[model samples]
Target: MKVVFHPDFYQVYTSDPAAAKGRMEAVVKVIDPFAGFVTAEMADHNDVAAVHTEAHIDEVRRQRLYPVAMLAAGGAVQAAQIGLAEPCFALVRPPGHHASADASWGFCYFNNMAVAIASLKNRGRIDSAYVLDIDLHYGDGTVNILGDKSYVTVHNVDAMRRDAYLREVADAMDRCEADIIGISAGFDNHMEDWGGVLSTGDYFEIGKMAAGAARRNSGGCFAVLEGGYNHDVLGQNVLALIQGMAA
Candidate 1:
């Protein structure tokens, strides 16, 4: 897979766990041998503005988070665009599922998933899209920005039991019909992570189901980093999903 990433992503931009040292390194260390790297770019001002208010954009700039935020958002766009041809993963920081149009929390400044999906829609590259957020938390920001859009459907897995969770993902994939599928891939739900629910193999199954759905629809699929705190197992979890998607 062509993983969209940048060395600058290694910078600890905030005090949040998402920005802690070694978070990005953990994933890179393991995936480096299995994936090709693609340099991440900064998002266009218009692209950022498409889903965020100017005030919100200014606020990010005021906090000195504008550059990295834009980079992460742009990386998502790059991953989504590349996904049109093949599956791709974006290793980015400062997770964006918590960011809304005019407000943000949970270490997020810009909603990267929304920005990327909107960019694809704006370009008429996709008629409809499905967002399968496997993160531990709900993607309220993604929902806030895109929930009402007729062309987009965002589903955040919320089952508590491992069996139920995997079933939920399988069910969602079975029902999804779209031109592209995006996974708001977050490893925090891993048994070793904060959420302490899913296993590494579960992530692989989720990724495989997503890829199978996209293939069935003759569409594209991609993923972007969101949350996962355990550096010890984060890399292996990421690699599992990547391997499943590629499979």
Candidate 2:
């Protein structure tokens, strides 16, 4: 697996836990030996503008988050594109699932998943997409932008129990039919993280199911960074997902 990342992602851009110090480092240290890396670039202004309102972009700039936010979005796009041939993961932040078209919260600025999928669509790289957001919270921002699109299906698993959650993911993957699949990977749901519902091995299952779905569809799959605050276990959880995807 090729992971899209940048050293700048190590910078603590905000007081938010998503951007907290050592958050990126924890994940990187674990995955570095297991996977190849691809440098992330800042998203083109036009690409960012494609999914975000000018007002929203301006607001991010006003907060001095434009650079890092755009970089994260770019990393997402890179991961998505690379996924066309093989599985990839964007180890960048701030998490964007809570960000909407014109408003953002949950430590997000631009909707990185939306921007990347839209960029692929705009470039005629893919005819359809499936987004599986395994975040602890709902991916309202991703839905707000890509939900209504006839070519996309954004599934934010709402199941809480371990069995129910895995079943839901399995069912979704069984039904998935698209040119590409993207995972809004968030480890906050880990037993040691904020949500405390899933285990590290559960993440591997999710990733395997997603990769299997993509393979069944004869398409591609990828993931991007999201919420996972427990530094102690965050790296292991992320690596589990990556290993599964690579499987």
lDDT for each of the candidates? 0.94, 0.95
C-alpha RMSD of each candidate structure in angstroms: 0.5, 0.6
Give the alpha carbon lDDT tens digit for every residue of 105-212 in model 1: 988999999999999999999999999999999999999999999999999999988999999999999999999999999999999898899999988888899999
lDDT of 1 at 238: 95
Q: Model 1: what TM-score?
A: 0.99
lDDT accuracy of residue 228 in candidate 2: 94
Cα error of candidate 1 at position 71, Å: 0.4
Write candidate 2's Cα lDDT for 102-204 as tens digits: 9999999999999999999999999999999999999999999999999999999999998999999999999999999999998999989889899999999
- Steric clash count of candidate 2: 0
Question: Backbone clashes per model, in order?
Answer: 0, 0
Q: Which residue pairs show collisions in model 2?
A: none
